[model samples]
Target: MVTIKDIAKELNLSYSTVSLALNASPMVSKTTMRRVKEAAREMGYKPNAMARALVLKRSGIIGIIVPDITNPFFSSVAFGAEQAAHKRGYNLLICNTEWNDELESHHLTLIVEKKIDGLLIASVNKKNHLLEGIIKQDLPLVFISSAYPSARCNFVGIDAEPGGYLVGKHLTDLGHREIAFVGGKFNSFSVQRRYAGFIKALADQKIAFNKEYTLSGEFSIESGYENGIKLLKKFPKVTATMAADDLIAVGMLKAMLERGIRVPQDFSIVGFDDIFIASLPGIELTTVFQEKKLMGELAMNILLDELNSGGDSKREKKSIVLSPRLVIRNTTAPPHSE
Candidate 1:
């Protein structure tokens, strides 16, 4: 509750002098600056960030929007952004959209109203018009884990196609000729790129790709469990599966376990986004590792660069794609010799 006026009164200094001293402006003598800081500490004075933002025209608070925080992958992304922002003397406001367009819009509106410094996001959908408004406002925006290519904005994401291709290569190398893909929504670019890569890898190995085996749904464990029934029934000949995410792979394991199908012996599985659960002692899911933290950190760095650019910051748009690596675990193995 202590304000600069209180410190000025105690120090018998002008309000402007106190303000400059508190900010460590070189205009104020170092001795005066030290005394003002001491007075501030003694009076328990705290700078009003909002008031500072008003005068400076920057909130020093970045906003982040993610589809689902419950997903470990998103959580990791948030962590990375928070750490990166904090290290740069900034704060974060995270909004969860729960995979709903309405919520995403509302959150974006709120960010604009609050005059947020910048935005980092893994948006709700591909056709997100919400970004256009933010851009028009001249607020810096960065995309993480997803990209809106048409917008020509800064983006940091993984090379999902290569990751998917790697998964396919791993499965094919293990003699998983009768294979299919499970999980992911129909329209997600991440899912499509991954699936495309998988198919490309399959074709490179001279293996046939079957479109019927690909299934679409929310990228959640429950969706994975529900789709397992249909996938198992329709693709009975499938000896292996490449799940769109670790959650799906884990859910598939749960469904198959209930059906008495042992993994790697009866069926092998591969997943993307090597979430923490994938490495649990019993799970040990074979999945691709995307640098979740790096995606967030780079996104924030790019946004800050733009924000600091003031008027002349219209640099060439940037698109950074982080690499994905295959992490072989307990779930994948060569098909059993018949």
Candidate 2:
């Protein structure tokens, strides 16, 4: 436990001089500062973060709350956030809320109580009142994927509506009149916006919207597989499918394969969020590529900027909507001619 006192004693300087040097106080002479830094480095001195936080009123820690940790999309976002935080010499505290509002509220309270610098949250529910309460507290927060319609908070996420529209249009353009949508709960804003886009796209193409073709399922592989089987069984004439996310697409692919229904040959499929698994050898899913890494990094950067800018800096509520690109892969193709 090497302390600043040890470095000062070794260099025959006062503790204040060492502290000023470490803090990069402009008052310290450059030559003396250099010597103090060298001494501290030689002694392998490490500052106590808790003590420093108490003195400076900065925890040097940021909290990230996600809906589910098991999902590859969220995991990849976390990876990017961790990398960005590390590069800026800050620590990231990650918590998975498992899409539970109570757990999400609990984690938010704990993180705030711990005095984390800021928060990056992918909320369990867009309507979580706890989030509005946190916003009123003037805590620097940036919503990752989910956002409240009226909350005055910064947000970073993809334009999901357009992404969904593209999926619908692509399938429709392939001469497929009968298509189905799978994944996401109805209450979610993400699901609603995506479904709206799908419907709008269909309307643009003069294709009748069929309520029976839309299926709501949990955002999981198993849910996708189960719902996919039911949808196919119920709509045997369906020629294409659009999934809410990559995991759903993968699950649907699994079900299709198991049922001896060849993809693109019998039923073309498209997915959202081109996750790592989407490009796997057998599952070259044509999907919308949401820049998950960039979104995470941007959210963290916004949080860090807010933390460092102090409380008086005009609270900036920025909304950044990133565009999703369509990644053409092997899964999507024109309907097979007889």
Candidate 3:
């Protein structure tokens, strides 16, 4: 492990000059900085991430907490965040909370102990008061997906309600009257917004919104399958189904297919978050296209901005809500012939 000191010694430069040049401080001339960088590269010198962090109060690491990495949506988010971090010469440490409050709390505590520069959370547990303490301490905290309703912080996500409304409106326009909804936990902020928007859209169209048609499950294909069974049996007259996410939609698709229900002929379906699997030839799920990658990039960039700007008390926080587009595909159609 070659150190900056070795490069300085080899170049016969002062240690302070070398350090300033390596940091790219404006105090050091650009020519000197270039020469120092080149020399460091030639020497294969690696900056001591922890050692330098102690002096500068920057760990060169951003911490990201997510519920599940196995989900394609979250994978895209991680990819975009990783790309942005690399561009800015930083690294990210990702922790999967698996929807456990204790796990999320543990990761938060560890990140704080590490003196990590910033945090990005695709939070599952909204009641985590530790997060409030983190925010109060002025750490750069950015919510990557849905955030708490009242917390004043940087947030990056699609407009959840509007995205749901898009699906509802599309179904309604296609002459779908008796529609059913499948979604994640009702307590989730994202779930609530989506359900609310879906209901509002149906109400605007004067379609009867049946409370019995709304069902909650975990955000997984298995959960979707289970709910599909209940939905079809109890609401046989349903003309279409609106899923809160692509995964749920995909699950429901499987259930319907197994039951010999012809898609778009017997029933139509719509989903949110046009994840990769939604575009598979057999699936082709009509869904709202959220800029998943862009969301991650924006969240990381926002955190970086917060970290670099000193995150002063007076700096106003901002939330970035991207637009969602409806991707019409094979999964949806007008009601079938009676």
> Across residues 41-147, which tens digit of lDDT does each residue of candidate 2 receive?
78887777777677668887888998898998898888888898875557889999998878988897898688787888875576767667777778788888767
Tens digits of per-residue lDDT, candidate 1, 1-338, equal 89988999999999999877765455778899899988988999878877877766778799999999999999999999999887555799999999888898899889988888889987557676776767766678888887876677788998899999999999999888988898578687788889999999999999988888888888899888877777788888898999999998888889888888888898999999999999999899999998987888889888876665552336677889888999999999988776
What's each prediction's clash count?
Answer: 0, 0, 0
Q: What is the C-alpha lDDT profile of model 3 across 53-159, one tens digit per residue?
A: 87777888998888888888888898899899876668989999887788888998998898888888876577778887887888888897788676787888977
Tell me the spans in candidate 1 whose CA falls farther than 4 Å from its real position.
1-48, 311-313
Where is model 1 poorest over a 10-residue stretch in terms of lDDT? Answer: 305-314
User: What do the candidate models score in CA lDDT, each in turn?
Assistant: 0.85, 0.83, 0.85
Q: How far is candidate 1 from the true structure (C-alpha RMSD, Å)?
A: 5.0
* Clashing residue pairs for model 1: none
> Total clashes, candidate 1?
0
Q: How does candidate 1 fare on TM-score?
A: 0.85
